[model samples]
Target: MSKSKTTIAKPSVLSDFKEITKMRLALSVVFSSLAGYLLGVETVDFKTLTLLAFGGYFMVGASNAFNQIIEKDLDALMDRTKNRPIPAGHMSVNTAFIIATLFTILGIGILYTINKQTAMFGAISIFIYTCMYTPLKTKTPIAVFVGAIPGAIPFMLGWVAATNDFGIEPGTLFALQFFWQFPHFWAIGWFLYDDYKKGGFFMLPTGKQDKGTAVQCIMYTIWTILVSIVPVFGFTGRLQLSVVAMVLVLLAGLWMLYYAIGLFKKMTEKAAKQLMLVSVSYITLVQIIYVVDKFIR
Candidate 1:
């Protein structure tokens, strides 16, 4: 009986770890960082690439862990977050804190090995996320804006890791990710509006599921597409995109924009969810296209 219980406890612990770190989300962030690194690199260095992947994951994980700790009570109040480790009573706040602290230290240490700029940006992402974004969620809808900063960093963080310099390339990458967040997150805010409200978190710009919010989603989707094509103009230095690549990127953006407009016309939860999924796919495809264009050029 004791041996059987030990096996069950092990799986439970692993599940709790995955939940605390938000494993899927962290991996996605790491992928963005790698894509950025690939776009910036003239020739790949697998060592630095590997380090960036692990470091990026650790940093995002740390931020998420800290977020869960700070929002434990609020998390319990919402269906979307109620099953998280701390809120579910599967892990202690102290244990989560320790894990977060360790991740912070390890992440920064690993990133610093690449360069000071990479580490600095990583640290800033964590600070903005845990200090500013998390608390502001309960106070105002502007939290989404603040949260976008950290959310946008991983892409540019890769460029900095690869080049160890701050330039127009990374800045453009940052802008692309930064603007992309509004539509993506607002779609999430639109569908999950009720769930978020239960936690006192207002994520939409107008703070309601009305025409006003839908309009903003369309507006930002336009802005994201515009920014995405900026590289084709030959003004973003090393970030230039071929005409073919630009056309492909435009098509992908338009695909997402269609869903954004659908949300405006339908104004239903289903439409919002569709926009959210398309926005996610749009960003991922854009990143992959950018990298492929770079090498093929």
Candidate 2:
């Protein structure tokens, strides 16, 4: 239940949850959904956008909460995640479950107010992230691929929510994000290889940060850039980017690829970190450019 309904939790207990939810990550996911909505809609609806943000945050937060609960044991084994609420004993599993349930209800309900498809996709994201991706981490590197499924949904979910269509337009948005996630995630896997190994999570292909991993990252970065430029060709039914947007997005992609290339050359953690930051910047900038280009042109 919401805080208003239950006895107020202790301050530090609340803080435990705030940390566990990964609020910044949740907000970033919401931003992608908002960008998709902006791009899909002919006339912007603030109400729908607000719903998208809130619903997206709650769903992603719920997924994160459940992931933490499931990974509590593994998290305790990893230095980076050892301080998290569940693994640190700052919060009980039951409390986390309640929070996750409440978020799910609120998220799906809010998205349902917009459309059934939106709500369905939101539920799917949570389910896949928590059920499939969370457990797969310890079993195989393919977990990253599984995780990318739900990770890439927000953008397409926004488009579906706005237009109630799951055609080439939304598919293009999904494709762009889906391919972008590999390079971004592999970079993190490259830097945090040892930390993840402590948790028994094999994120890199071949389970090592070597030429194979770097080569895959480069290939996916190329794929991401190519998909981002697809709208410029006017093949996608309902999506079209101005030539200006294509150029800007290409430049951003290259910026990310530069760091990827750096990682390939040095194979150093520092280079991997640079690639991660550049990937984050590239995605955010591309989303902003897509939305802005929608109106200016």
Candidate 3:
């Protein structure tokens, strides 16, 4: 009697790369970094800009990969994250860990070649995200605040990479991103409250979606809007936003606020979802406005 042997296939390198990086999220981070670079640089340096883009992607990808690795068990328990590469068995923990370490090293090395501060910030972002924020998610609702620190670093990191120093310009960038994160993340928390609760993650300040959380979202959204327009008044000094840009940004903020208010009034899942979508649009559009304003003014 003869027996046939079964062949096991290996995963493609490209697919593995995408799964580890969470390509879509990485791309979004890269886009924000590009906008920061454009705003920070008075005259475009194609070579430097390219380096920042690649470095930003590598750093953020590593952070996200490590986050998935740490939360693999919780991810499997949550409906929203059950299909993630780590949770779904698309990649092994050891393989993901190796990939994350490689990315962190490569990313920091690339940024260090450009300048030391950029590399330092890259390392800090990874450490805060993976080491502090990942564990805090399961322990406290304030994790969102702690997580926002590293989450908001990419925009400012790009500016520092361009100038190789922290200044009013980078400070302004940091402020804009810092305030924006609260509303943006809260909206997501509101929408995914049930799923997060299931996984023992405390995302909302109240740990329950209600008027208080929605009101906080609205307040933060307003603060972000105010900060976005402050550059127009010359108060930001080197990072001034123009009148046209200010008007455009204010409109976007109002649009986002409308959704936030609607969520407060209705307090329904549909309204929460709408606010979440609007928050995403608001951040993306505001970043574009900042970059375009730099060129126009």
Highest lDDT against the true fold, candidate: 1
Q: Clash pairs of candidate 1?
A: none
Tens digits of lDDT, candidate 3, 215-257: 9988988888888888888877678777888899999999999
The candidate with the higher TM-score, 1 or 3, is 1
lDDT of each: 0.94, 0.90, 0.84
Candidate 3, superposed: residue stretches over 4 Å from native:
1-16
Please rank every candidate by TM-score, starting with the best.
1, 2, 3
- Model 2 TM-score, 2 decimals: 0.95
Runs in model 1 deviating more than 4 A are: 1-7
Number of colliding residue pairs in each model: 0, 0, 1
What 10-residue stretch in candidate 3 is worst by lDDT?
A: 1-10
181-226 in candidate 1: lDDT tens per residue?
Answer: 9989999999999999999998999999999999999998999999
Highest-TM-score candidate: 1
State every prediction's TM-score relative to the real structure.
0.97, 0.95, 0.93
